[model samples]
Target: MGSCIICGTDVEGDGRICRSHQEDVVFDFRGNSPDQLVANRFYRGVVDGYADFGVFVDLAPGVTGLLHRSELDVRLESLEWEPGDDVFVQVTGVRDNGNIDLAWSIRQADREFRGELVHDGDSEWLPTDQADETEATDTAVETEPVEATSETEQTETAPTETEPTETADEPEPTETASEPETTETASEPETESAVEAAAEPADSVTASDERVTVASLGDRVDETVRLEGEVVSVRQTGGPTIFELRDETGVVDAAAFVEPGVRAYPDVVVGDAIRLDGEVERRRGDLQVETEALAVLAGDDADAVETRLAEALTAEARPEGLQPLAGDEAVAGLGEGLLDAAEAIRRAVLESRPIVVRHPATADGYVAGAALERAVLPLIDDAHEQSDAAYHYFTRRPTDEPVYGMDAATNDATRMLQDRDRHDEKLPLFVLVGIGSTTESADGLDLLSVYDVEAVVVDAAVADAETRAQVDTLVSPTLESVDADLSTGALVSSLASAVNDAVRSDLVHLPAVSYWAETPDRYVTLARDAGYDRERIAELREAVALEAYYQSYQDKRELIDDLLFDDGGDLAAHVSAQFREKLETERETASANLVTESVDGVEFAVLDTDAYTHRYDFPPTPLLLDDLHRHHANGDAAATVGIGTDELYVRSTGDLSVRSVASRTAEIAPEADVSTAGRREGKISFLAGERDAVEDAVVAAIADAF
Candidate 1:
C-alpha cells in the first residue's frame, strides 16, 4: 500500500490515490477487460486510426474504442491530429457487441489532473474474495436510488443487521456492539453512494453526457448544449476570449469574458481539443456561443479525436494515375514525380499553409504561375469558408531574372520573417516556377533552407547537381534523360493539372503560349481541342508577355485571369496586336544596325543595345535580343551578342557559357574589366574600348564554351 499524494490516506498501490482525489489523479490503465473497468472513468490511450464514421483509439492491447461523429463537438477536418499521438478519453460503454464507446474528456493536461499518476485498477488492488465483495457493494448501491423512488408506496425491503443511525443534527454511530464488525463495515460501502446521491442535485446534468456539432447549433439558439472541437483560433479582444471553434458541419465563436485579456482560460490554446457547454446566441449579426464551461479533452480522449480525424483523411484518397495535360512521351516521362509534388502543394492548401510562387517575369513563367493560381485558389476557397483565405494562403511573385538570386531571396526572407513574428504564420512553401535552377540560385536557396522552409523547384532548364539538394522537389528537365525543348509553362501547366485535375481544361492553351517559336504539334492540338485556335493561343502568349514585362515583379492576377480564362478573346487580341507592333519595330531596328562577323568558322551577329535600340522602350533587352538573333542571324552555329557599355546579352542557337568568356577575356584582354552578371540572361559586363577585342575573344570563347 502507498499513501495518497494529497491528504495522507492508504492507497492500494503506488499509482493509487484515495477516492476523494481520484479525479485529480489521471490513470494509465494496464488491463483491457470491461468487467473491471469503471464506466465514465478517463484513461490515457493512443490514437490507432481514423474512419469516416469516427476515430479508433487503443486503450490497451486487444482493447479499442470508437469516438463516433455523433459525439463530436467540433469539425472533423479542423482537427490537427496525426496517428500515434497520446490523448485522454472516458469509456462511456463496453457494449453487448463488445464495441467500446468513448466520450471526449475535456480535462486533457496533466496539470488539470495535478495529483500523481497511478497505474493501478480495482481488480489489481483486491484479492478474489475482496474483489467480489466490492463488485456486489457497487451493484447494491446502483439499485438503491431506484428502490427508494419506487411508485409503489408499499415497498419490499431486504433487512440487514445494523444499528439505526441518529438524525443529521446529532449524528451517532450506526453499528451497535452486537452487530458483526466486518458485516457493518461492508454495509458502510452501500450507504456511502446513497448518502452522496441524496445530497447532490437531481437536475444538474453531467458535462460528459452529451456532445453536439456547430451545424446543429442554429436550431438550438438560447439552448445550452455541450460541444467538442479543436480551437481554430484564439483571440483575446481585450474584452473576452473569442475562440473560433470548428466542427465538421460549421464554425462558431465561443466567447468567454470573465478573465478578459488576462486569458480567460489559460490552458486553452489554438489546436486544443476542448469540450464546451454554452448557450447559442446571435451576436452582432453573427452566431456565437457564450461559453459557460470549457474543458480541454486530454490524454486518450484527445488522441481518439485526432486519430479519428486522421483515419477520415486517410480514407479520402488522392487522385492517382492522373494523365498529364501534355500527352508527349518526354513530358510524360518527366512527370514521374509530378504527382507527389502536386499532392504536397494540395496538402498545403488544405492545411492553410502559405504558398509563395516565384516565377520568371516571362510569358512562359507567367502562364505557369497563373495556371497554378487558377487551380489552387478554388481549392483554398473550398477548403476554408473564409473569403479572404486565398489571399492569406497564396502569393505569386515574378522574378526579373530567370534565376532565384540573392536579391529575390533577401526580399522573400524579409517578408517571411516579418510574417512569422507578426502573425505567427507557418513558413511558406516556396514554389520556384521557371526559376531556381542553377548555381546562381544556391545562395538564395541556402537562405530559405536555414529557416527549414520547404521548397519546390519546377523548371524546364537543366538544373545543376547542387541545386537538387537545396529543394524538397526538383522537377527539372535534367532528371529525365530525354532533353526535349519543352518550356517551363509546359511543365508547370501539367503539374497544376495534377494539383487539381478539375483545372485541366482551363490550362489547355498554356503549353502553346509558352513556346515563342516552333509551337509543338502536341500542344497545338491540345489548344485547338480546347477551342483555342492558333490566333487565340498566340494572343494569350502576347498578352501574358505584355503583362509580364510591365510589372515584372507583381502577380497581375485579375488582368492575367481575363487574358487567360475569358472567352471574349478581346484582351488577348488587343494585347497581341501591341506585342507584334512593338516586337516588329524593334526587330527591324536591330536588323538595320547590326555588326555581323565570323570567328573560328562560327557566325556572330552583334547589336549595340545602348547605341542602336531604345533602351527603356517596349521589347525588353532579352526579348529584343531573342528576336534579333532569330531574325538576323544565320548558319548552323549562329549567335547574337547585344554589347552594352559594360554588359553583353547573348542569344544563341546553342549552349554558351558567359563565365568561360569572362574568365578567358580576363586572360586575353584584362583591361576590358569583364565579369559575369546574370546566368539566365547570359549577361557579362565589359569595357566599351574592349568591344572590338572583347567581341573577337567572345566569338572564339563561344566556340569553346559551346
Candidate 2:
C-alpha cells in the first residue's frame, strides 16, 4: 500500500490523496525522528485526516503532523485527493502538542529532477526503490554523511541495479518511501529547486494535472462549485431566469432553472454583489452555469458603477487616433484662432492695396474684418500669380491689436484702399439697409453714398405705393439726367413668376430685381419704374405685403386681397369706361375723315323725279346734258366740260332703266396720234365713265386704235 513518508500511514494506491494533503504526497522528507525534524523540511507522510487547509500527516511511524494551508500551492487544493494514495512530504515543525507538521515538496523535487536530468542524463526513476541501495553504496565509499550526501545524489544512485528493477512497476509507492531520504541527501540542490518552483506558479500549475480553474473544470461540470461577481442586470423569461455577472476581466451571463420555491426569495437586483454555486453547462456557444444556490453578498458600489459607465462612454466617444481631454480644459475659440492666422492674411491684403468686401450670400451675422481677411487672403495670393489687382490691408504696430479693431490710421488707410478698389474694380458696395417708402428725405441716399452702395432696397410695408412709384420714376431719371450710372434694383412679387417674367422680358438686360416679400414698398417702386401701371403696381405691392404679413401671422384674407385688387371697388367697370370713351372718339373721327376724303371725285345735279329717271343711265357728258335739260326744265343747277375724241363717248340712263345717249362724232372717234395731254384726258374720261355701256365701247375702240 502507498503511504506518506512523514506519517508512515497507509494511503490509497492511486498516487493521490485528499487535495488538502497533496503537498504531503508530492514533497515527502525524512530525518531521525518526526520530533527532531525541522518545519517545512523533507518528510515521509501518510494521509490521516482532511481539512480546508490541508491533510494531517503521520511522520516517523506514530508522530502525527499537521500540514498547514500556506505550505501548499493553490494547485494542490484543486486535485482529487484520496486516502490510500502514496505521498511524500516535508517536516514543517514540532508543535507544542508533539505533532510534526508536514508539507508536500513535489514542486521542489520536480525542479531538482529536471535540473539533474539536464546535466547528468539521469531520470527521476532512479530515486524510487534504488534510492536506498544508492545511499548504501555512497555510505560504503564515504564515512561522513555530509560528503556522502552531495547534491548529485543521482550519480551516487546510478550503479544500484537490484532495487531499480524491483521498484520499476510501482515507482510512485517507492517514491513515497525514499523521497524524504533523497531530500536530506540533496538538500542544497533541493532548496534551489524549491525557490525556482515557487517563483513560477503559472508553469507549476500547467505542469500539474490537478489544478482546477474554469479552464480545468470542464470534466467536473456535474459537480456544483461557487463563483462570485457583481450583478450587472437580470432578465426573467418563461423558461428560466438569466443574470448578468461582471468581474474585472469581463461580463458573463449565469442562468438558473426555476425550481418551485426559488422565485419566492428576494429578487436579484442590478448592481448587487452575489455569490453563486452552480454546475456549468454549455447552451448554444456560451458556457452557462446553472445556479442551484445564490446569495447576495453585498450591494454594488455606486461610484464604481458610474466610473465604469463613464469609461465605457469615453471609449466609445474617442476618435480613431485622438482622445478628448477629461475634466475642465479650455480650447481656443475658432474666431480667435482665425485671428491668429490673419496676420499673414493681413500682410497679403495690405500688399493687394485695394479689396472690396461684398455682401455675404447667407443671412447670418456679419463676418469680422479679421475673419474676412483670413478668408480672402488666399484668393488674393492666387490672383497675384496672374498679375491682377494688388490690394490688401497692411499693419504698422508694435502692440497686439484686438481682432476686427482698427486704429485711426489703419481705418483711414482701409477707407482709402476701399475707395480705390471701388474706383478701380468698378464694383459697388452692396449694403443691406431698409428705406421706408414714405421717407423721401434721402437719408438712406446719404448712407448709400457713404457706404458706396450702388443700389438701395426700401422696405415696402412701411412705404406707400404712390410714393414708391413716384420715387421710381423720379430717382431713376434724375440719376440718368445727372450722368450717374445708378440703377434701382428690387425683387418681383413671386420668385417663380419673377423668374418667368425676367426670362421672357430679358429683364437681366435692364437691371437686377429680386422679388422677396420681406420688403414690399421697394418692389413697388421697382415695378412702377419698370413700366407697370399704378394699379398693377399697387396690386403687386399688396401681394408682397401680404406675403410678408403671412410669414408672421399666416392670414389668408390678406393674401387674397393682394391677389385680387388694389382697393375693394368695381375694377371691371373702371377699366371698361376708360377704354370705351377712347374707342368711341376714335371711331367717329375715322368715319368723318373717310367721308371728306371720298367727296372730291364726283358731281351731280338735282332733278324732277321723271327727269332723274331719264338722266340716270347717261355717261358723264350725256348725263351732264340730260342734267342741263332737266335743270332747264326744272331750273336745277348743272356743270359741263368741253369734249375731245380722246374722251371716247357718253350716254345717260334714266332712274327707271331708260337710257339716253349723245356724243359729238369727232369726240367719239378713237384718238389717232393724240397729244400727250389728249391721251391723258382720254384715259381719265375712259376710267371715269367705264361703268356706262357706251363709254365702255368707245374706250375699247380708242385702245384698239392706239
Candidate 3:
C-alpha cells in the first residue's frame, strides 16, 4: 500500500493514488496490456500514427488507444504532433474486445500536474524522481556479479579456441547497455578477428542444404537458417533496416542492424531476389529474422525464385467457387465479376498491398463499407503478426459525393505516394463501393490508372461503358437485368461475403438494414433467421443514417461497428431517437411550404428547399426529398421535386432518368447551364441565377417523359 501523492490519502492495495486524487497526478504507464489502464485517469502517451477519423497513441510498447476526432477541440489535421511525439490523454473507457477509447487532456506537460508517478505493474507506483535511480541500481547489481565471475574464469584458466567465435556475437562493450562488459576482458582481440572473418564471405556461394521456407520458420526459432526470397519492401527504423521478404510460402520481416539508424545492406533494394542467413526470433510476439548476412542473387538463382513466387501466388489468389449469399437469381448472374473482384482483394492481401475502400457517406454506403471492413480485417490479422497490421493494411474512406471525384483521387494519390517514398510501402488496391459506377468517376479512375493502381467497383447503379472500361473489375445488376430493384448496400454486402466466407453468418442480416422499406422477402427471412427482429433492424438503419450524416467525410469505423455488428441495442436506440426527431422536424417544415401543380395532365408537388429546409444540418435535401415523395407522390403519374438554390432532386412513383431530365431541361432553358449531379438519386444541378427557369423546365421535361 501507498499514500496518494496529491492528498496524502491512503490508497488501496498495490495502488499509489486514492480514487479522488487520481486526476491530480499524471501517470506514466509502463504496463503492456489495456487491463492495467484506469479509466478517467490521465497518462502520458506517444503518438503512433494518424488515420482519417482519429490518431493512435501508444501508452506502452504493446498497448495503443485511439483518440477520435470527435473528442478533440480542433481538427485532427491541425494538430502538429508527429510520430514518436509525446502527448497526454485520459483513458475514457476500455471495450470488451480490448479496444481503448481515449480523450484529449489539457494538461499535456508533466509540470502541469501536481505529482508524477510511474505505473509499471509493480506492487506500488514509483515516484518519477526515484525511477531512474532504482533502474540504475538494479542494472549495476545485475552486471557486477557477471563481470566478477567472468574475470575469475579468465584468471583461473585460459579461454578455449571456440570461445572467441561465441563472443563475436557481442560487437562491442560500449555499443549498448545489453552488451556485457565481461566480453572486453575475456576475448577482445580474438573476437574482433572473428567478426572480421565472418564479414568477408557474406556473398559466398551458399547451397540450399538448410534453407527453410517462411511458413516453416516457427520451429526454427533461435537457429540460424538460410532463406531465399524477393525483398518486397524495405523500411528503415531507428535501430535496424527491416526488409519484408516474400517467398512461395509467406512474407516475413528480416531485420539487419548496422549501428543505430544506419541502413544495413544499402545496395539491396526492393524486388531483388536475395538469399539471407538469419536466426529467427520472436520480437513482441511477432517472428522476426535477425540477419547475420544478406546477398542479392543474380542469373538463374534469381529467375528461379521469381518463377516460383508467381506460380504460387496465382494458385493461392483465386477462390474456389463464387457462391451467392442467398438464392437471389439476379445476384447469381454477376458471379464472374464478383469472382474477379474477390480474387483481386485476396491477391492484395497475399502481396501485402493495402486496400483503400471508397464509399459515399450514406446509410447504404456505410453498410456496404462496414460489411467489407468486417470481412477483410480478420484476413489481415491472420496474415500479419504485427499488432497494428490491420490498420496499415486496410482503410475505409467516406466521400460526401456519390461519384469518385478528382478531389478524392488527388488525396489518395498524395497519401499513397508519400507512404511509398517515406516508408517503402506498396501502392494500394482501391475498392469503390456504391459509387464510381458512372461516367462522372472516369476522370478520377483515369488519374489512378496513370500509376497502374487497380480498382474494383461494386454498385447497383446502371453503369456506363466508359466507367466499366476504366475499373479493373465491376459488379452491377444492369448487365443482367434492370427489373431487379437491388440496393447498393445489398449488392456490396454479398460481394464482401465472397471476399471472406468466415463472416458470412454475421452478414446475413445486413441487407435488410440497408433498405428503408419494401425489403426483399429473401433478405427479410435472412434477418429473422439471424435473430434480428423488425424493430431492431429499423433502429440499426436509423442509427447508421443519423451517424453517417454528422461526419460524412469520416469513416467512423468503430462506432459503425457497434451499431451494426456488436450488440449495441442501447446505442442504436439512443441515436435512432435523434434521427426521428430531426427528420420529423424537417418534414413538417418542408410539407407546409410545398405547392401542388399539374403539368399536361401530370400531377407535380414542388418544395422550395432553399426557403423551407435547413441547408447544412440533419435531414439533408436528398433524404428529405425521398421522404416527401413517398408521402405525396402516391399516384403513378405524380412526381415530387425539391428545388434548392442551384440543385433539385426528383422523386417519383414511376421510372425516371435524372440525366435525361437534365438534358431536356438544358435544351428548354439553355441559359441555365444544367447538369446531372447523381444518376440513381435523381439529382440535377443548374445555375443559381436561373433557378426558377430550371425548375419549370425540369417539370415540363418530366411531364413529357411521363
Residue 10, model 3: lDDT of: 79
Worst 10-residue lDDT window for candidate 1 reads 148-157
Which window of 10 residues has the lowest lDDT sum in candidate 2?
322-331
Which tens-of-lDDT digit does each residue in 97-121 have in candidate 3?
A: 9999999886554423445566875
Query: What do the candidate models score in CA lDDT, each in turn?
Result: 0.69, 0.32, 0.78
Candidate 3 matches the true fold with a TM-score of 0.75
lDDT of 1 by residue, 1-706 (tens): 8765444588775434567555444456667575555576677788898889888888787788898865653445545546887777778878887888988765453322333232434432211112344444444323222322211111112222233455333222231111122443565543443233222321243443567777687688878888877676654432345676755444566765332122456567767877777677764335677665677788997786667545533432244756777576666776666766786787666444689999988888898899899989987776554434577679999988757889999999999886665343567888998888788788999999999999998887778899987789888776446455788898888888888888888998888989889888889999998898888888888878987998688787767887888649776888889999999888888889888877777777888888888887778888888877766775443788898777778787875666777788677777888877666678887887888788777777876665
lDDT of 2 by residue, 351-426 (tens): 2333333211111101111123233434444323211122322111111111111232244345555444322222
**Using TM-score as the measure, which candidate wins?**
3
**What is the overall TM-score of model 2 with all chains considered together?**
0.16
Report the Cα RMSD per candidate: 21.0, 48.4, 11.6
Scored by lDDT, model 2 comes in at: 0.32
